[model samples]
Target: MSKVTLAIGGMSCASCALSIEAEVKKIDGVLESSVNYATETAYFEISDDKLLDVIKSKVQSLGFSTSDELHTPTEKTSGENYLVKFYISIALSLLLFSLAMWPLMGWPNREVNWFIQLVLCLPIWAWIGLKFQKSLVRFFLTGKSNMNTLIGLGTTAAFVYSAIITVFNDASVSFGLTQKVYFEAVGFIISFVYLGNYFEERAKRKTKEALNSLFKLSSKKALVEIDSKFVEVDIDEVQKGSVLRVKPGEKFPVDGKILRGSSLIDESMITGEPVPLLKSSDDLVYSGTINGDSVIEYIATKVGKDTFLSQIIAFVEQAQGSRPKIQQFADRISSIFTPVVIAISVLTFICWFFLGPEPFWGNAISNMIAVLVIACPCALGLATPTAVVVATGRASLKGILIGGGEIIERSEKIDTIIFDKTGTITEGRPSVVEALFNNDEETTLMDIASIEQFSEHPLSNAIVKYSQDRKIPLSEPDSFEIVKGKGIIASIDEREYVIGNKLLLEESSIEFQQNLTPNEIGSYVFVACNGVHCATLVVGDKIKSTSKSVIDELKFLGIETWMITGDNEIVAEYVAKELGIEHFVANALPLEKSSYVESLQAKGKNVAMIGDGVNDAPALAKANVSMAMGTGADVAMNASDVTLVKGDLSKAIDFLKLSHGTMKIIKQNLFLSMVYNSLLIPIAAGVLVIFDGPMMPPVLASIAMGLSSISVVSNSLRIKTII
Candidate 1:
């Protein structure tokens, strides 16, 4: 399957987005499609790449436009600016309203006064009519309705009715009807709705601030070494394997490994950690990170869209466009909202015409226009997506890459969190703390290092580094084999060697005396050679300082914490105790770890797994929510729901806090929108008119409808401050 993102244009509300999505999904070879009204973008997966153009054409046929590029702040929209239109509409509407109120001020309201009001309302009505005409045209052509449909219907009805009253002033006496024209109502309705759209659009732009900041962090220029001399060039001109020079306090233009010089690099842009890290030869530096206090020459390994910063931006964009489960409810309601509201408006006009007081025609038309103007589908559509976009973007700024809105919803319900011991709770860097041998120490160490050099395990690397540090010469083993969850078996100089934990030694039938006791609490490896015990090596890794505090905070939040590791029971117990964790599993292989997570889920627990190694991938994918350390293996990160850059465990806490805050805001927005429509639609329909209660004027109804959408967007923006 192939995926494509298109910048959608001419989307006025959520219903327009639904129409585009429905039309695009009907195309052959289109697998799945989603359109985010708040972001004004559509994401799709298709069976064939050729269907992309077909999908775009389908969207355009629905009275909208599509661009191949993803939507950005600077991108031009096909629609007119509502803010500028609102300014013009309001200025004219105020004059029309004053003319209608001339009688209330004890002034003679002449026929020319009515003509003057009509002239003032003309420009305002024409501008907003053109703005909503596409929605009306789409409804006629495709049998779909949107928020703009209601606005267009209500405003046009008022304008037409008032135009007839203005032209025939004496006919009202014979028909026993009120002679008041609603030119002012038409102008106010269009003006207020435009003002509401202006505020909503402005708030939506603020939600993307975090993503825009990331885009701005990328360096535009690079100094490359050509002919052994440096020449500044555009960042795009530099290719992979090109050597580049970065001066003090300049941002690195690409992801590369340092070949010469050293410096303290400030990587806070990617890692969200303020402390600059000391980087030397062979250390990898990423794009968008600032160089600190020294000159460094590095060979670019990854450039352009392949850079780390670009990938993060892409992830953020995809996540912000995703629809969460909570949004599905709102989407369903919005799909039929316009049609249902129009039916109610028609019903309102019939009831008020027959049952209302004197001036029945006037009351019926005014109430029907109010009903159509006040029912807002925009608020319902903006509720969840606006919150999701803001929260996901804010989370990315803190180096927490949430997979999508689904992850955020799941994160809020996590009751049990499982952490991998290595590189998660503790620092993954292991060192040889102590070593003892029964036979020749040098020869035994040489034999162990020779076999371990071929292994990619952290323990193996530590042992190899220890031997090299001690100046012990090594030889390649004749044969080598790795025992899963155990150690290694190798042959050197016609003698077989067994090197692993105690389980591997006993399984190999190697006799070894248990005479050594280490003062340090660390992982132990027992080695035997030719059926004789040779050496006992101890590898120690320190616990991270934040692990204990993070665990304590989780406990305070009424969450259970569990530790799982592949190390021996002794090492696991020590690390668990240090972190104040009571539940733990030791000597667990990759499959065993996954099984433990499944068991927790089977017991009705919402478990979140955090890990940072290849061995943790299975368990990470099995948990309710999986978080991967940024410094860990690629496989583990890919399988995870959230990536904590710089491998900071504290970011897991940040993710939970952000999820809770975002979900809360979404619920608030939904409740406010539902309640606004529920309470006001009846008032607009003349529910209280029989009891002699005041009727909702079309002007007031338009204001209420506009404010409903603006309030929801404004409420969604509050998540940034709370999180």
Candidate 2:
């Protein structure tokens, strides 16, 4: 075994990398291969005399252009060049087609003279067949090939053999003999196949562009400072220890430290948190994050793929490139399908040639062509990929990012829906709702928020948020100190302040609020100042407005809903009852969530677990369908098959519905393709002549393909426009 490394381009996400790896590994003599997506390369170990060109062809066939080609040979790709070539090809093919049909358009039989037909079909096949012919030439030249080799040899053999016979003999048709013409089959196949793949390739390229565009958001140029004067230079031209100046409101182009000035930075682009963070001198800033408030300068520490934005892109690319289990089935089946069908066509021709005594050459040629045209996998090829791409695209717009086709299929039928409680179905933050002052007009509520802000706790954030929302003015408390075991203590305007639970108040020897409602399902904090009770802040966490609607919609769709949480049984029961969820496993541990999901699965139900980010990671990995929300933890995001980027629970069910619709479309397409084939294959094999009449295989093949392709495309188009 030896090592082989090939550069793999246009893989923007992990799934893309995985798909390429999967395709290459399918070939014989390929022992192992490792593809590094960030570097855009694949390394392989192979046996002697293995077919590298076939592997490259396989990659190209799966829609990702390989990087090993030294010249720009794939016509043109990605930009305006591609558009020009595509339009030109279409126009040339269409013109040639029209010219060939001109004489027949005015006829009663709509028929053409055989000589005229041969002349007309000449350019149509040659002009458009150049690509196929080129590949065919390369295959014979190198002895390395795959389907292209098969297509080239089979079609070229049929066409050239027929052309020679026509030129040599006046009688072009011979029964059980060496004379027959199949120029039409070899001529038209490549032209139409190219037409079928153009738009499909376009969509795939755009999906890659979306990732590239994200990476492109980083500034490619930087302002370098030398001798106190700023000089413009490309980011790659600058490196670590290079001083740079970043103007206020201008995006910092590189990951660096602040050399001069202080400013706030908006990191929402990477973190999804919109709050502008305060940064001072010597603080590090990430590339592409917005600088705010003041003019700031920094040193360029990192650039290019080393930048944070590039790292994020790399992770996404790697994940997308990892192939899913189901796609392997489709690819293996589809790749073999065409070859098998073509073989049957050859066999059908051979049988007819030997068995029929007074055989007709046209009839035998038609049967072979029938097999080629009828066996086309335009429908089978489109069946899974079309719906998968569409469903995944549609799901993305609705906040759910499905990983692959298998996930899409699983999402189509959801039986038990499990939701994580905090952050997912309820407001995770607590707030002060009621503040009471007894026998004092000292602004007790205001003083409590002032002290509470000094502490770092979820309960404190709740109170702070509430007080700020109420427009309460808080003073910086003097002599601020946190009582380790109890709470925080501070002196506001020379007056001592304390905020915490009952223990802190007791330690302060102050009266405190008691009998706090347990069913309140929220953390609480108290306030005291100058050794006397100032106010009691009732902290409460509210349910998200969207949660109710999400649940209601799911119920309306007849989906069974459940809520599982580590929160107390009382709190869990209260929230579940409010949302009208009947099945709940409250106070369950993180592992228990998966256990509960497994229990549902034990009953033969397809379970979808909806969870808060990190806490639900395990359960998400366990469920048949895992949907993680925007607010979820990074672990949850990675674990779940479907990630709701918007954190909209309503889209959870909507995405399910979208998958269901996509599956329905897939089923419909398969049914139509099979039904059409069942009728056409038999008829093209001359099965229906005894009953009805005879039909041309070429015309029938074109019709079968046109119908299948147009319907698949039309149905898949629904995904693009879907919400």
Candidate 3:
């Protein structure tokens, strides 16, 4: 199946995303679909690409706009303009509120002020309140209710009731209405709701800014050599095999190999390292990295979406669109919240009308309007997603690439962390340390290096470099064959030789008079000729400086740390002791490492596996949360959920801390919303009126509702401050 990402518009809340997702799934041949309100994008998978147009039409039918165009369009100006409208509405609201309160304050001329308040509220509702009206009408047509439906119904009820009192003064007075007016409440409700949206839009924009920062690092234009002459062209015009000439201090425009010259390139954007790397002939340079002091010419290998920079951008975009498990729960609650609130408002109206004291009509209408105004579900809808967006963006800035919301949840719960030895705890660069031979060490080394020269394994390269540095003459091998994870077999000097691990030798039924093993803390590779042991060589790798500190930090947090390695028991124990790790599994195969992780999880531990080699991919996929070193193999990175761009083990602590902090903020937001609704709903329903308590005014209800949403957003933004 093929997929497409469309830029969606007109999404106001999480419920809006749900509405779009529900419609998109109905299209024939659509395998799956996800709509994210935070990013305002819709991703779809289709079995047949021919039905794309029909799917787009289905999305638009739900009253949302979409574009398949390249390069994201700039945001609309509605947020800024809405703020201006709110200020004007608020000014008029304050004036109308003061005039309507004149009678309660024992001031004169309050009896004739209803007409003036009504006239002032007209502009507020007709102009600033039109959005709520339009949303309410759309919902009425589709039988769907949202926050807008509640606000529109509450404010419109107040304005219409107040207008009736103003027009039929004599009849209202006869019915003991006393010309009571709530025009001021109508003005305040609309103003506060709009103000809430304006603030929300501002916070959402801050999250978008974090994502856009990545796109800004790329250069738009490039200078290339055409027929030995330099020419400037757009980055898109430079194709594969094109020779691109980059000057000092300019960014590389495409992934390429150096053809001439050398320079120190800054790869901080891509690798999260501020240090400059030296580049020369045959070295690779990626797009968006800055060339530091010398001009260089390179031939482009990958262009457009195939470049490394584009992949990072695409990765971040896809991650931003994913919903965490907590966010899914929030969406489900919001889907049911609006309708339940509408039902409560109706019940509140019935209860107040039958039980209210003098001026029953005015009290019943006011209290019922208060109930509707106070119960907006916007805060509930925004609780999880806003926190996820801010937390993910903050993590990106710190060089931790989290794949989705579920990673945040999973990372927080990790109680045990398992680390692979090679390329993880150790530097993964092994060098021959000692050579033990029964007859001649030189003959064995030269013969083994010759056959291993054709292999790209790490140990193979180390053997070849060791032989070359010793000035040992090598002979060609015939009929070379490699057994993965074991050894290589070839014919050297009319004799069959095997070079590999002890397991490979045992499988070959090799026998030697004395099997000498190295006592040092390093790996051993045995060489055999004609099914007999010839020599044994030892290789050692340096441990990373941060491994011990990382282990200490994890232990300090009450988490257990374990080391799993394919190395011998002695080497594994030596490294584990140095890092202060208490648990380890030595001489483990790739499948055995994954089984160990599963066994820990079966014992109720939340396990996280960190590795940077192809052998670690299965274990990485088996853990609750997996991290891949930025400098590691591509297969390992693809199998992991989190990528440490600098390969710094210290970032593992940051990942856990970030998850804890983000989950804390989400819980706080959800609590604030739930508490606000719980306390205000009863008062708005007039339950307090029994004890002679003040009934909740529609104006105060609107203020409380808006503040609840603003507070949730403000709390989410606090995640950016986490270190």
Candidate 4:
């Protein structure tokens, strides 16, 4: 049998994990399996008979995906099944509560029949705790530490010892445990935490809905042309070269090329572009894109798991399991915590047996169970994950996606943030910042917009967008010639049209006025129509509205901001100084940017690099942390740890604060959980039961559990203010 760990996505609660575990157990040749809602991964032992493919296909059939292939792990959606388990546990608990208290309330109990208490609580204890028993066995076999070991030790000792004492000891002996079983407490330990796990899983599921939403876009069926007839078929059944008929307003069912028709396609799902793309024969189409008008017959090239939906789902799932940058501390804390609590619980039994008045096995077992029940790592396990879920959820609302926990963790420590010029700090798209015309003709705007549309360039694109806003339609031109690094030459009827920068105009020996404003930053292009200067199109990129705010926020938060751009020194300096960023590297190439970020790291500075160009990919991957704007090239986005959805800078601020808040909460939760466990469990075992009155185990467990939960939840809620 091969044991492989798969990071499972779409788990939101402990019960959801449990459901997945139950499903996994149904597979033939599967020996054991477990799913953790907090960690969002499924652990399973599969025999040689069950292939990995079979295991994975079965998992996918259940509306979830596994990340067995990703080089790194990622967070995933925890959905609704987990909530069902929570309700089940709660319902069972309520039933037990009513049953156990009936005797106390004098509701036809043999005045406290021990057997009645045992019967009411046994189902909950056994049903809810079977998983814990499995984990305990694993722990004993591996000698590896886990929270379940302590629980198994405490609850088992409490039940067996109490049963032994009750069977042998006659009543009125005054031995603490022999007198009363507290079997209900054993059941309560299993049920109470299941309640916590339920709520936590629900919260986790709700927070991770981003990936779920992303995965929902894939089309399930496609209309395939079969025997000269159009018929709908499941997407998975459609193979390559199958001509699929896609109707207007339908989402494309598979990745393919336009074979027999044309339409406007909304590629925004993948590219995040707001505009729709016109499709003709041979125009590539991606699966899940919306078709605007005209029926399109496209040949399918990929489907099912090979499609982008499956890739994205797999990416999200795998990313959740990759090593976290800041989880070392948590590992250390959890490691030290388990053993220390175990030792303390053991010592509690010994101390009460030797030094205290109620030193008998009865109270000794009660104290041990108290120690295990009270010292649970619910808060510890929850600390980091809760904060991450909350922070990541808030980020998604603002169109930011954080893949790794360490990105946020290390991003919080970043002292310097380097921004690329084009598409990072600037809008990247050139527009007519200023337009000038000597003539007062009413048709001047139309003339320029129409002419510029004949040529494709940054400057021409700017004029086109501008003219479209003014309701101008471009006309086709005859004899169009594009001069490299210069102007465009087109013939309108018989006259010649020359449009380009000053250098291009000079090369053509065409004179044009240089009445350009000095303060404006952009490339200057002068257009001459029919041997007369018509208009000048000034193309330049504008700084994003949020860039300055991001810089100022970083500075205010005590981090330094810097810039590196391939633009001219003056333009780079202008943007840098305007944003209040003091450091900059002007005229940097792709390699230069990577080297600069590398140098910073070598100097012991943790640097975060933000960029959007394909050239920025290397630098982004090189940085201590990386952020990609939504409009960034695909490679850059893939290389980056964080992606900004709106191609804006404001989210940079949100990420930093979110991580810091989460880490703070983790510390608070750990401290709170530890402090409560240290103080209360001993007291519950009747440490001072003889002096300050014997404290009830149930009430003490409730208070300790409450304190741990309150601090954990409160700390987690603190991150809600980050956005």
Top model by lDDT, which number? 1
C-alpha local distance difference test of each model: 0.76, 0.62, 0.75, 0.66
Estimate, for each residue in 474-503, the C-alpha lDDT of model 4 and write its tens digit.
Answer: 666667887645668777556577887677
Residue 293 local lDDT, model 2: 64
In model 2, the Cα lDDT at residue 234 comes to 85
Error of 2 at 403 (Å): 3.7
lDDT at position 147, candidate 2: 38
TM-scores of the candidates are 0.55, 0.60, 0.57, 0.64
Question: Best by TM-score, which number?
Answer: 4
Candidate 1's clash total is 0
- Which has the higher lDDT value, candidate number 1 or candidate number 4? 1
Candidate 1 least-lDDT 10 residues? 71-80
Which pairs clash in the backbone of model 3?
none
In terms of lDDT, model 2 sits at 0.62
Residue 644 miss distance in model 2 (angstroms): 2.8
The C-alpha stretches of model 2 lying farther than 4 A from their native spots are 1-343, 355-363, 388-397, 433-442, 454-458, 514-519, 538-541, 552-558, 566-570, 585-592, 688-700, 715-723
Q: On lDDT, who's better, 2 or 3? A: 3
Summarize candidate 3's per-residue lDDT along 623-709 as a digit string, tens digits: 788898988766566557788888888888998999999989988988987888778888878888789887765446545656886
- Full ranking by lDDT: 1, 3, 4, 2
On the 0 to 100 scale, the lDDT of residue 309 in model 2 is 60
Better of 1 and 4 by TM-score: 4
